[model samples]
Target: MQKFPFDAIGFDLDGTLLDTFRDLGAAVNHALVLGGFAEVSVETSKDLIGGGAKIMLARAVDAQGGLPADEFKQLYKAMLTYYSAHNAIHTVPYPGVREALVDLANKGVRMAVVTNKFEGFARDVLSQLDLIGAFETVIGGDSMGKGEDGQFLAKPHPAPVIAAREATGNGHMAFIGDSTYDVRAARGAGVPVVAAAYGYCDMPPHELGADVVIDSFPELIPALEAIGSAS
Candidate 1:
């Protein structure tokens, strides 16, 4: 077999590795109810993801008439509190994720998960699902600390992905994700990227600007091999 395209692969947690919209949506609904807003359909929650829990709740709240900053903050905390306990109850890996991960490991490739979810939350979910051990490290939005504006230096910043590369030995790296955040992060980090079309894509798969777009996790290896071959 030909050499694997990259030495390390950094993956986005939600949408890319796991199907988490149901739990995310539930948390958003919990916050919405607490804030006296109507709950949105769980399916629509797919569109609210990609930023983080706070943003997810914010969007849902905003759609219903918005909220005062103070009230919103409290609601955000409530969402987090509810989520931390029930996050994995309805969450599970997307099809072929486990097999693909195992295959990557057998290829001697290094892996890391870089997500906008809080570090503790990401760790807990992955650990509960028994997928945490597959990664060399799990870098959350908070892992890099907040920037000058008090916002997390998370996706689209490239710092976490670059850090993932460094932690995985820094030879050559690739990113796999499902949103513009992931594409921008990989581009900023100077790595090729594969978009997961089957995941919770915020835009059309072809429009995500990935080096390649895969419809399923099972297509990932072949896509990466082709990308590596061409590059």
Candidate 2:
């Protein structure tokens, strides 16, 4: 068997490791109703994902003629509250995720989660799904604290990804995710990344700019190996 190249692997949470749009959509709808905006379909919530929970709600609100900043803040808070309480209602690991994680673990590869979601929420969801034990670390958007812009140094910034690598104590790290944020972050961190095409990608899988793309979790190992060989 060809050995996987990276010593540590980092994964994105929402849309990558877990199918969370249903719960996310419900939370968004809860806020929208509170804000007096028409509810969007649960399936439509997938399109609103990519950035994080705040961005998800913001997009949904913006689509409905947007609330004032202060009002939007209130609505966002409400959404977070609802989500925090119900984040794992319909969230689940994509097929083969458990098997792949086991395979990676058996190979002695370190694992971590570097997600744009807030730390508490990510931990909560993973814990509820019984997947939290698979990773050595979980770096959320808030994990790196806010930058000068008062925004999280999350995905696309490389900070959280770098933090994940440092936490894993491995220099040879590969990241896997399903969005531009993940791709850009990995690029910024100077690490190879693989795209999870079956997840809720913000763009077409081919356009994600990943070193390799896998249609499902079962393909992850081979995709990582391919990227390693190319490097």
lDDT leader: 1
Give the Å error, residue 45, model 2.
0.6
lDDT by candidate, in order shown: 0.93, 0.92
Q: Model 2: per-residue lDDT, tens digit, 79-125?
A: 99999889999999999999999999999899999999999999999
lDDT of 2: 0.92
lDDT of 1 at 30: 90
Ten contiguous residues minimizing lDDT sum, candidate 1? 50-59
Question: Candidate 1: deviation at residue 225, Å?
Answer: 0.3
- Per-model RMSD to reference: 0.7, 0.9
Clash list (residue pairs), candidate 1: none
Candidate 1 wrong stretches, greater than 4 Å: none
